[model samples]
Target: MKRAAMVVNPIKIKDMRLLHREVEQVMRRHGWAAPVWHETTIEDPGFGQTQQAISDQVDLVVALGGDGTVRNVSTTLLGSGIPLAILPAGTGNLLARNLGLPIRNRKVALRAALAGRDRAIDTLFVEIDTTGDGVADESAICTVMTGCGLDAEIMASTSERLKARAGWLAYPIAGLRHINARRTPMRIALDDNDFEDERPLTTVLVGNCGRLTGGVRLMPDAEPDDGVLDVLELSAERASWAPLITQVLSASTRTTSQVRHRTAESIRIECEEPTRVEIDGEVHEHALAVRISIKPKSLVVRVPRSSKPS
Candidate 1:
């Protein structure tokens, strides 16, 4: 029987005993050994637990939490060649939803873990220069999109209580109040290009994959394995944002000139003022600059056998 090390975020889980029984029964039916479990704590999310799982040499490592938890476990599992299975929990299950995983059915998700096919996807390596010393003060890994300015503001402002009550809808609800917020001036560089002054923009996002919660395709052309970063910049010369909001609500690839889209292997962004930046869903306050680059097809994840990703 194959072994698995399950890394779980206990805070996101509703019932411990019930989940244990359910997972154990599934393991038996699949002819696999009961998984060795590691729970995430406030201080250490899933990185340490995933490292321990890797050390255990388990056949698989399961991420059972939100996207942040998935990012942590996936980063640790990168280049380890051990496949990852995800059981989506909490508000924005961005990666799980993008991969067409069963978000609400834990049993089916676990079954997919046992029977699904494996596909390798890209992950982003973020270098943050919070103090603007031309040196990276912090580093992070992103399995989903990361952004600055208003986009980061929405993610940072979305409350846990609101998400628990509203699910994916909470994000849009939180975003409504900030639609008219002031834009920030920024200098952006893509790949080998020199930094250029761009219009004061509402937000700048660089994504590994292009799917937001509630069926919004914020970066519709983005592919998780495409080996390129999908970059989005939103600016409005006028104070009103109805057209931009409509574009996002439509979920269409076509966009107005206020919305600019590009693809690159690496992106460097420097803000004129301190801006909030987010890696996955966690916010970093007072980030002056961030450099994002793609680590192409570094994460192997279990996807539905019938699902095909280009």
Candidate 2:
């Protein structure tokens, strides 16, 4: 019998007892006897609880929350080769959707986690210079994407109160509020190639998998295990807003032409002023420089066998 550890986020959806019952039922059906369970807490996210899962030597660590919770657990389980199963309870659930896992309801997601096929995916190492000392002081993130610029600012400014009330729609409401204040001069270099642009970028995103909030396909060709990062650089020039708007509106179903894109094994970004950077939707303040790179096939993640071509 295989041991499984389920790390759940209590704040996400309602009916905890029902979810647990469904998860346990699935585990029993799969011959995973009495899988261990853990819940995320404010005091411990990355280290303490995950280490517990590791000490128990579980075959899998299930993340049952949003992207932030997934990131927290994934960071702890990195390199352990213990596959992660996501049960999306977050507002965006971007990573879950990218993998083609069912997210319409918790029952469906829980079933997929227990029965889905396992696939290896690439993880990114993000280093941020926090002290302006020209040295990276913090590192994190495993799936989806990370970036620093106008988009990071929007992420930093978004209010939790609004998110709890309106779900993912809160992002655009906050975006509308900050749209006029989003311009910045940014220098982006992809593997030593330099490109400088001054625009009110709504956000600049790097995706390992193609989906964004609200099922937006930011990078139509991104593959999580491809050993490369897909960079989507959006610029809001004086006359660029109309087209940019069009792109964003269409992003949920299709790609827009207003965004510039590139793929590289590594990237370096620098900004004139200090800014907030988001890795899988969590915000952090930093001096300017960010180094991102792929850790090709570093993590084992559960995915549907019939998932869309990555």
Candidate 3:
């Protein structure tokens, strides 16, 4: 890359000094100009900094955080024609995991980011009914996946203090505590499909890509560049989750009657009661409904040349 910028989450990195030194050395060795660096704040994770990178006309914008930072940076870079490079530094590096990027070694991650192929990926546009206006208007973009119901509980209940020390393990620990949490009744429709009547649902997930943290593939057929979103629904009783969890933990597509899967360019979901929601692992306020649509091949991402399609 001729010129680039980095948007970092300061709190996630263990040693900023070493990371900066190594990154700078790599850029210099590659004969690239020094990158403009931007740090994420509590108020602004990465949106504003990504905008600044775009305004400065950087060839690439590297996101050095977790899923939330990746989503924000992708939202800002949408339609900008600038490719994003992932240098994961936080727990639940979902996007990087799905993309098959090197997450364990900083050197490999940096090299793959700097000398990788560009892949166009789909993004989801979500309009949430946050105003109680009854109309879905307020919007946001989700780069990995958007979820409601049980998964939201897992994310919301996971203590930040625990997350800081235990990383992605914090989620499941909190989740085990809420195993018997009641399911919400929801009505849903996909693409041109008729709206299904409200029924108790343990979780509803709409994904641009299938993989979750630790190589778990929740939707085997979901493809980021496919121009359609993958929908997975769990409507089983609490007692039935054991086998379902087994399937998920094993990354197996085999599912029973309580599980449903569909593919759509758009989806509309409304719950009988307000329920918490999450986008790219970031919790949002409880909402009674949401409208999600796919924008195919909307963002360009950098991945290792050997990377398979996410």
The clash numbers for all candidates, in the given order, read 0, 1, 0
> What's model 1's lDDT at 62?
91
Model 1 earns a TM-score of 0.96
Please write out the lDDT profile of model 2 over residues 69-183, one tens digit for every residue: 9888878887887888888888778778888877776666666666778898888889888666668988887588886776677777778788889988988887776656655
Clashing pairs in 1: none
Count backbone overlaps in model 3: 0
Residue lDDT tens for model 3, 10-31: 8878898888899988888877
Worst 10 residues of 2 by lDDT: 249-258
Over 42-71, each residue of candidate 1 has an lDDT whose tens digit, in order, gives 999899999999999999999999888998
Rank by lDDT (best first) = 1, 3, 2
Q: Which scores greater on TM-score, model 2 or model 3?
A: 3
* Superior candidate under lDDT, 1 versus 2: 1
List candidate 1 stretches off by more than 4 Å. 237-239, 308-310
| Residue-level lDDT for 293 in candidate 1 | 97
Tell how far residue 215 is off in model 1, in angstroms: 1.1
Cα lDDT over the full model 2? 0.77
TM-score per prediction, in order, is 0.96, 0.90, 0.95
